[model samples]
Target: MARITMKFGGTSVGSPEAIAQVADIVKHTVDERHEVLVVCSAMSGVTNLLTEGALTAAAGNPTRYQAIATHLREKHSNAIRQLLPSDVERISIRDEVDSLIDEFETLCYGIYVLREASHRVMDKVTSLGERMAMPIISAALRHNGVSSTTISASYLIVTDDQFQNAGVLFDDTERRIRRELVPVLAQRIVPVVTGFLGATRDGVITTLGRGGSDYSAAILGAYVDSDEVWIWTDVDGVMTTDPRVAPDAQVLPVLSYGEVAEMAYFGAKVLHPKTVQPLVDRNIPIRVKNTFNPSFDGTLLTHEEHVTPSTVKAVTAIRDVSMITVAGRGMVGVPGIAARTFAAVAKQNANVLMISQSSSEQSICFIVPEEKSASVVESVQDELAHEYGRQDIQRTWADDDVEIVTVVGAGMRATPGVAARVFGALKEASVNVLAIAHGASDYSLSIVVRAADTERAVQSIHRLVVLNGISPNVHAPEPIKNAVS
Candidate 1:
């Protein structure tokens, strides 16, 4: 029997009906004799509501979140009533929900009284979603005849005190999980663990940033040394590209670790960007499966190499980004210009996404999030104030009218002319390339195009690379002449 850690995203456990279906899936896994460890995200839209409520409270209106709290109370109670089989279990879960709702209310009131939401306070506020989700899921599983227990990740995964974006302390976390969770799994009682939120060594609640639930599952899966980790989400699997951009986009049945990383970095939303980090060293495969349609075989992501038919697998785009260009004649032979420019960006805590430098070393351009462009430009200008005064650098500005389109495939490394094919497709589609950056790893080819041309660029590239299966050119030497002789 294999040990599998199955993680259900928000949509998988969005309601009573969805929870019932999730229970059925869990029961089937148990029937297959696999040791199951479950991780769950909050119901759909719960965390967002929670965050909004906290902000409302911080804005000096505690009464607004009261309605939200009441709505959540009713929502959870309705799910318990509809899905739970036992009357006693229903009553018990209702009481649990009541206590959780009360706690949520108390926290919001505190936020209102304080009139400020610190990072730590907001982390605590947002974590209530997953905290409420696990217990309800556990109760639903029990009603369906599966013995289950709700576990908090805070007790299992220890992290540093980074507040909203805490980093997991793996050594202590692994030891604690083995000490705590292995025994629970040994008894065949499925442990339904909360996702997203963990605690520091000092026992303060901290979140793992956005998409932390998927990161939670990966962290737990690595510690438990599961053979495979299955992430159940709404989509079928990782597609060639967004179907909205390319209507005929198809799901990729298999992907390598490198390919998925590139896809995720380039805006593929199927998996969390950090989901592969923990599993990479352990060699555990992460399967992206759809909860609604379980019969279909979803994509399997692994470190193992597979025979690939296409030179490029997918074209993805990140929209609403700004490209910052810093140019001047003074930058032509400057030694520390690049370093100093990036240093300023780092000082502002802004992330530099993609960077390109002219071959003549006259100027440099890079991409940052649209919202961060102002701060990035400010930092660069300040760092180069002397250069500006000396007329060494011309100007530094951001263009918010651009988006990034990336072509990702490991096969591209070995295939010649892939770049030409990509450029040719974009040219044929009449998409103007603004800035291009290709890394040394050959993992991806990233180009900046007008935001208006994003969908067209993506569609054209997908058609040429994925649908048409552009192959590398191979030349058979003059050996055929000898055979003819």
Candidate 2:
């Protein structure tokens, strides 16, 4: 039997009924005699609650955190009552969970006094979700007649000092995982590990950022050299596009490491973008399966991506984005303008998503999350204060009304006219393309369009390129009378 690392997402363990399903799945897997390490996400929405508590307390509101503490108590205690049958077990676990929440209140009090939440403190606050999740999952596993124990991932994975988004030290992390978790496996006890969390060498706890539970599973699976990392989530698998957008969107049975990475980066659900690199480096496989529909084969991610004749695998979108552009004749052939412009955005800690530059070197345009657009514009202006004073950069503006749609496939690299087909579809739909970026990797083609046109643009692209079912309501359109360059 192969060693398997199974990760259950938040929705899979969101409540008593969900935890029961997870327990049943684990018992069946262990009954088959495979060495198993289970990774668990915080029960759905707990991390958000923890984050809200921290921010509200920093805004000087104790009443909010106190009420939040009580609400948490109700949610978990109600869960304990339903999951653990024996009275003694229920009392024991309830006390432990309450103590964890009490510590949450204490941490919030500290933040309230200081009126500031540092990244370190925010990580600490957010990590409580996973901390509270592990032991309860351990209890639920035992309730299902499986031998299981909770292990903190921080003890197993070591990373650099970056608090909110720490980078793992792979060599050291590998050594630690081997030293600590192997013996537990030898004992035939399933180790249910916390996801979305890690620590520095100094033992200060850190988080791997949002959706990091997937990354945690990837790291552990690679270090332990498991046969595959199974991500159990809500959906059947990765779809042609989000089902809400095009109800006809079908599940893709297979994808390549490169293809899935692009989809995740461009906002597909069920996998994190950072989760792909570690598995790709080791040639390990990732399988996305539905927790509700356990029998479906789901999507398999490996090195060899499938390419249809259409040369388009999927169309996906990232919304709530803005484009910032800097333009001037004086910027032509300029040396450091681009570098200085982005260095300023970096100082603001803004994430730049896509970038385009004219061949004339006269303008630089990029995308950022819409919420960060105002501050990013301010910072870039400040960075170019001298250029503004002298008029070298004649115009700088942010348009916070855009969304990015990306078409993904490995087949695109060898196929000609793919770009023409994509633009041709969008033109037929009358969706204006604000900016365009073709990824250096050749796996994706991204374009920015007005936010209002997002769903229509995605639908239009999905209809033209995807091979299976023809989307309804897709039609040939009148030719464009005028075009903008």
* lDDT per residue (tens digit) for residues 114-157 in model 2: 99999999888888888888888889889899999889998988
For all candidates in order, the CA lDDT equals 0.86, 0.85
Q: Against the true structure, whose lDDT is highest?
A: 1
The 10 consecutive residues of candidate 1 with the worst lDDT sum are: 476-485
Global local distance difference test of model 1: 0.86
TM-score of predicted model 2? Answer: 0.92
What does the lDDT read for residue 251 in candidate 2? 78
TM-score of each candidate structure, all chains considered together: 0.95, 0.92
In candidate 1 the C-alpha lDDT for residue 150 amounts to: 87
Give the Å shift of residue 79 in candidate 1: 0.6
